[model samples]
Each structure stands twice: as structure tokens, then as C-alpha cells.
Target: MAYVDSADRGRIRLRRSSLICPGDDTKLLGKMETVAADVCIVDWEDGVVPARKEEARRLTAEALQKAWRCPERVIRTNGMDSDLFETDVFAAVAAGVDSIMLPKVENAEQIIEANLLIDRAEQAAGREAGTVEVWALAETVQSVQNADAIAEVPRVTCLIFGGGDLGADLRLKRIQLGSNRTLGIHRYEYFYAYSRMITAARAAGIDIQVTGFTSYTDLDASREDAEISAQFGATGALAISPRQLPIYNEVFGPGADDLVWADKVLAAVDAAAAEQRAVVVVDGSMVDGPFIRNARFLRSLQDLIDAHDGSVG
Candidate 1:
């Protein structure tokens, strides 16, 4: 249920932008340092063909062993039901990745089994048993249905929403919404999926990450998608390209307007404290305990992001 401190060069971990790459792509793997992301996830599933899985695993192991600039390093292993899942977990754990992302997870039992395997991997590598973390993706109907239970699983720190496979699973068609725009491969169709994942992760006291906007070439589209995600309470987003990182970071992190609001709230709260008042009104709106707490949380999140960006040199 608890974790130990790892011995690697740790940075302040944030989840604004996570860059996903195939494990076997030597070019992308080599360019990891140059990518702009808060986290780097090397993939072992979908990214590689069946024939090259073993090769990808070996290369992925090597990539994990090598140092990268990301504060959090993650490995996305094959599904829990796959025969190769054990090998993927064992190799990733031995290589010292910060998290092991369990894909296509349907329920807590898979996470429980995966946790046992991760514990063994950690022990086998002579590291503290709970140091490596577990991340689960809500990619299927079953997964989305059981998201809350999965998030409540011990050591499952973050929950991700994968729309690609999910769309396929649901047989989701490109339906036209009010704007007359068909739900083209953008991160827009699954509003229900987003809400469920967000609520589940938050309810379980964990972070939530949305899959990247597939329209990588369209920065405006990415920004719009990121705004939608942030508006819906997503803490972070995945990025298929380095170009999407800035948009995600900007949209998700506190902006100038948010900072201004936070400052105003803090000022009002401080004034309220001076008057020995438990609640206050700001901008003609009620500011209570919960509202003040949210303002403080945003300020703290901004502070953390600033500190990490400062240390990125």
C-alpha cells in the first residue's frame, strides 16, 4: 500500500504532458531527451508489430535503463491477459521505470494480480517492493465501467483514458454534434468516458490523464481539445508529438487569468481571516472553505510546475 523512495535522480513530478513513443523506434528513443514532456512513456503495445515484440522489448529495456529528462518514466506493457505481460513487467521493473501502465484493464483483479507481479519484479531487482508504481488505462467498456474500483486499487497512482481502442470497442461512429462537425478522430466524442474517468480518479484520490489529440499537426485543434479536457477536470494529457506538449502544459497549468483569480481569492481569504470570519464573498460570489481550498490547490499546482520548469536546464 506504501512506497519507498527510489535512488534515481528525481525531479518534481508533474503530469501536464506525457509523450508516448514506440519502444523499438531507435530515432524517437534516442530523441527522448529533446522531447518536451513532464513524463515519457515508452510503449510495448500497439506501437510494435507482433513479429518485433521481442526486439521492441529488448530495445525498450535498454531505453528504460538509459537516463531521460522526464521527471516520470513509464513503460506501457502488454495487456494483463497477454503471455508477454510478465516479461514486459519484469524487464521494466528491472530497468527502473517510475510507473508500469497496465493497458486495457477491465477490473481490479487484474490490477491486484499485476501488483503481485510488480512486487516480485521489484524484489527480484533488489529494489524496495513498492517503489515502482502502477498506472491503469480505462480503454474498454468494461474498463470504463470499473474505473473507480481500478483506481481504488493499491499502488494505482494514475488513471488514463485511451480513446482509440475505446472508440473501436464501442463501435462509436463519427456523429455530428451541434457545431455540424463530425466527431472526427479528435478527443471529443467520448464526453461520457471523460466524465467517468475524471470522476473515478478524483473519487479515488488519484490523477487522470487523457489520451493525446490525434490531430497533432493542428496546434489549434490540440489547444481546443486540451481546453475541453481541462474544462472537464483532466489533470494531464498524452502527446504523440513534442509540438503538442506546449499546448497541453499551457492549457492544463494555471494561466494568467487563473493566477489572477487565485491571487484575488487568497487576498479575500486573508482579509476574511483578519476579520476572524470563516467564509468570505469575492466578485459577488460565495467563497467558502471548499472554494478557498481549490484556489490554494491551483496556486500550489502552479508553484510546482514553475519549480519543475526552472530546474529543467
Candidate 2:
């Protein structure tokens, strides 16, 4: 479900729920056929163990060649600083993935360098320039700080907020059972990082703003996380399990009440315009520039959902 960017530049994808599958896991990759996520990433980064990196690359490239039900097929490449970086990028590019998730990104120059590599791969593979989009992972504190510059890159279409990695970089305490996640209590710490990335992504006209941290099980907790993420302006979420997909999608999308409100606001605005007025009051609320913008954005999102759902059905 890709749409034109708000900046009137190019296309951006709608990823209400992005399911991450381990690259080396044949079983999981095979099971991807039965899932329904807006984006399915054959992860070559943290999800792949170092011992099986080659296997992951081979499997991911193979997976990309097959037609899957998911609209956006993407891969999360290893860090640019790593030796496997170029290998991962070239393989994914040649495989014709819809997007590349560059993980552990801490600056804009790394993404620029990645685009140079992507350019070479596109030319070598005889693919169109800019066919493959870049999705930057704002995991580190440095990346969060430089998110604006990173989002400004031309081919970059999405900013994946890497809350877990950012927590690790901040030296937050993790669970005792070798989990890299900080204690999930309250989860107020990542609000600042979320704010920085959300603002940067919006400024860059990237529509698919994402929260990239989740775990398996605990459906209640997943719903809470999804609701909180939506409250913070995230349009998408990274799902560790398929069970979380429906929860994320429902949380991020406009509800019946939202559509009702949008209908009323749009009607009010049309009425006011007919009366040659620039503003109108809807149920005691002023329908001005900001109100109109919100109404139109949500209405557009609902339309996208309807079209996509109809197509898939």
C-alpha cells in the first residue's frame, strides 16, 4: 500500500504492522505465506545470528524472488560499519526488494553511502534508479539526534524508531534472563526519542512513521503498547509475532467514530466554503487549517485501508 509522499516527491508505503521474520529460519519464511502484514521484512540484521549470516543472505534473497501476499517486501541489512554491510545491500538490491532497512544507523552520511552502493547495485542489475527505498533505523542516541538529516535523504521513505536498541545504548537495565529489553514497567523513557523521530519524519514528509520495538506473547501488553504508540503519532509498528498484527493495525487505523467525525468536519468545511467563509464551528470546535488537515489525513488513511482491504479480499 504505497502512496504519494506529502512533499509531492515520490511514493511512501503504509506499514500499519511490519512483521519481522528471521532471515535464516526457513520455517518462519515459509510460514510468511499465511500471514497478513503490510510489510514483511526478511531480517538480515539483529534477527540473524552471525554464524548463519551467509545462510540468511541466501535465504532472504531467495524469499524476495517469490511473490508473497505482503505488499512491501523489505530486508534489514547489517550495519554500514560491518563487513557484511555491502554483501547484504548488494544481495537485497539484486533481489529487487521494495525497501532496505539499514540498521544501527547513527548519521546521515551512512545512509548516503548506502545510497551510493544501492546506485551501483541498481545500475549493475539494470534496475531503475530509486527502485529500492531506504528505511533508516534510528536506534542509537546519535541517530535520534540526527534523525532530521537522515530523513532528508532523497530515497529515504520511512524512519523506524528503534526503542530497544536506543535503550541499550543509553545503558538502561535489561531483564536478568539475558533479554536486551529494559524493564517494561511504565515505558516512559522512550517518549523523548519517539518525539524526536516523529517530528523529524513528519518534517521530511515520510508518511509511514514506525515504532520498532516489540516482543512475543502478552496480548494485553501488546495492545497497551500499540495504543500508546498511536497516541504518540506512530502510524506503524514492528511485530515480533503475527498475533500482534491485528492489534497493531486496529490501533493505528481510524475507527468508526473517527470516520464519523471526519465526515462531519468535511461537511462543515464544505458548507462554510459554500457560504464564502474560511472557517466554521463544528460542535463548538473550530474547523480551521489544522482541523481540516487532520480530518483530510484521517479520511485519506481510511480510504487507503478500504482499497487495500478490498484488493486483498
Top candidate (lDDT) = 1
**Stretches > 4 Å off in candidate 1:** 1-13, 174-188
Model 2 TM-score is 0.90
Tens-digit per-residue lDDT, 1-313, candidate 2:
1222345432334678888888999999987755878888888888888999999988877776777777788899888899998888888888888889988888889888888899888888788877788888888999988988988886788888876678788887652211233556246777788788888888887844455335557677777777777888777888878988888888888888998999899999999889999879898988788888889888988887888788778
lDDT of 2: 0.79
TM-score of each: 0.90, 0.90
Candidate 2: which stretches are off by over 4 Å?
A: 1-12, 175-185, 207-215
lDDT at position 178, candidate 1? 21
Question: Candidate 1, overall lDDT?
Answer: 0.82
In model 2, what are the clashing residue pairs, if there are any?
none
lDDT of each: 0.82, 0.79
lDDT minimum window of 10 residues, candidate 1: 4-13
Tens digit of lDDT per residue, candidate 1, span 1-313? Answer: 4452222212224898999888889898988866778889988988988888888878877776666777888989988889999999988988788899999899999999999899889889998868888789888999999988998887787889887778788886743322234754345568899999899888777788988777678788788878888989888899877998989989989899888888899999999899999878889998888878778878988998877768776
